[model samples]
Target: MTVRKATDVFSEWALRDRDEGMEEGHAKSVNDMLKMVIPKFTSPFSVIDVGCGNGWVCRYLESIENCYKAVGVDGSKEMILKAKIKGDGEFHLAQLPFWKPSIKFDLIHSMEFLYYLHDPFEMLKIFYEEWLKPGGILIAGIDHYSENTISLGWPKALNVNMSTFSENEWRKAMLDAGFIDVKIQRVGIKEGFVGTLAMLGQKLN
Candidate 1:
């Protein structure tokens, strides 16, 4: 059996129009993450959505009156192309844990993305130090984690590498990555589904 790269699989999803379905599937969890986050930005804010599959979140962020900038970055070429075609905000083609943005943002978001990396905390460190401004917030959501139980087979199913750490481990990893005041919240649970485990952290001022 051959293990496949997550981005390559997602690029195919982009070509097949599966990205829209992914947006729909993750919408509830995404909304829950935003509900807690949006209130923090009393003034104008800028955001970057890592692993932005098709820029849906980027467009939504741009629609908010207080959002000065909304940028979407993804490793998949097809996904970025599709995002650009959708036409709402700036979209960049870049791989995580390696590609750093030219500027930082007030808020950084990643959903169901970090686990794909060999060292997810390496990307978290970058998110804390390079991707976010001082006093910035980082929100990372992952569905595949230990204790979730249902998600344990995701790596094998998708043929992609995923770091299956427990919830506490994720929080500790965030703290280890230099994110202060780290917290985790579970949201959007339904029948037979364990809600998304959203890790919230703040870059120290």
Candidate 2:
């Protein structure tokens, strides 16, 4: 789908309920997840948040003393606008496949956004080759694929699909993308319904 269509779909979802509390709740969840992943970095770092819906994650990173620079990129203009309104770092409205960073980051992050990509591995490779500095870290958090989630009520006609992978699968993919020391761990558990897995890896010199 085109970026405009994707932006419209996300904007519609964001505007629903018109509840500031919901947004705050989502931000809290994201922050909690990041806390688990960010400490793996040993020192001050430049970070990029891809598909940074509303930019909460980027803003949170900017608030940290060890974060050198925080940048956010999203396909949705409306989401980017919201991120800018939050006010801490730079927000770019650009679709994937056309995104080019002038500088490599010490950390690159994406949460719950990889499943939307048609070529996730290719994107990971690009991040490894072009966007990450030597010894940089890549963290991707995703919902695990299991029988319970396949049955969940999801829209069928949007021409969009989510592909979840097992922990080993993610580790292998990251390895193939030229990362080493790949580690995968589950972060949140929702009884028998859902869970999240965070896959982390480092670029080798």
Candidate 3:
């Protein structure tokens, strides 16, 4: 087994939800994400889920009436392999900010993953140009920076690196990347420790 960071270990635990009866936890989180994202989708549309750990969100979206195809992509090979076995949709393993897809999607989603990027804005711009169709929707779910409780002690203990931004900073970055109609809202609060921030935007014509 590879020496994995705490984040990677957590991601691996997500893959085991099917066996642990933790599907309910996954379902609840997906439901919250969908509730924040799905209103922007009007009709039958294709979706790409970036950093889709074990394809839980992809599978959840597939149950929706208007979601035609749900594709899952992840950087973790183990996660992708598990996703392929558990999900009906296609799963690919690729490093972020470098994936090239011939097909564009009506919606591109990233959850709990952007803060790990060294250059989130650069990646967002690439996603806008390469993955999203004109007038497409982008939904990103992040834990609020103001609420981040991972102190240095915690990071040392967990052996993971995390980066975060305030809601305004995220919105500005999206606008600078040429996204329009951007909106940010707090969707879920868990135990007063972690707060979910859902940012939705539309690609301009």
User: Best candidate, lDDT-wise?
Assistant: 1
Instruction: Summarize candidate 1's per-residue lDDT along 35-150 as a digit string, tens digits.
Output: 97899999999999999999999999999999999999999999999999998579999877778889999999888898989999888888888889999999989999998998
Number of colliding residue pairs in model 1: 0
* lDDT value for model 1: 0.91
Model 2 CA lDDT for position 82:
78
- Kindly report which residue stretches of model 2 are placed more than 4 angstroms away from their true locations once superposed: 1-5, 17-33, 144-159
User: Which 10-residue span in candidate 1 carries the lowest summed lDDT?
Assistant: 88-97
- The per-residue C-alpha lDDT of model 1 at residue 57 equals 92
Our tally of clashes for model 3 stands at 0
lDDT of 3 by residue, 12-85 (tens): 66556542344344354556767876886787999998878777788878888999999988877777777788
Model 1 Cα displacement at 193 (Å)?
A: 0.8
The whole-model C-alpha lDDT of candidate 3 against the native structure comes to 0.74
Stretches of candidate 1 above 4 Å error? none
True-structure RMSD, every candidate = 0.9, 3.1, 3.3
Q: Of models 1 and 2, which has the larger TM-score?
A: 1
Model 2 C-alpha lDDT per residue in residues 27-112, reported as the tens digit of each score: 54455567766787678889999888888778778988889899999887777877888786798988885787889999998876
**Which scores better on lDDT, 1 or 2?**
1
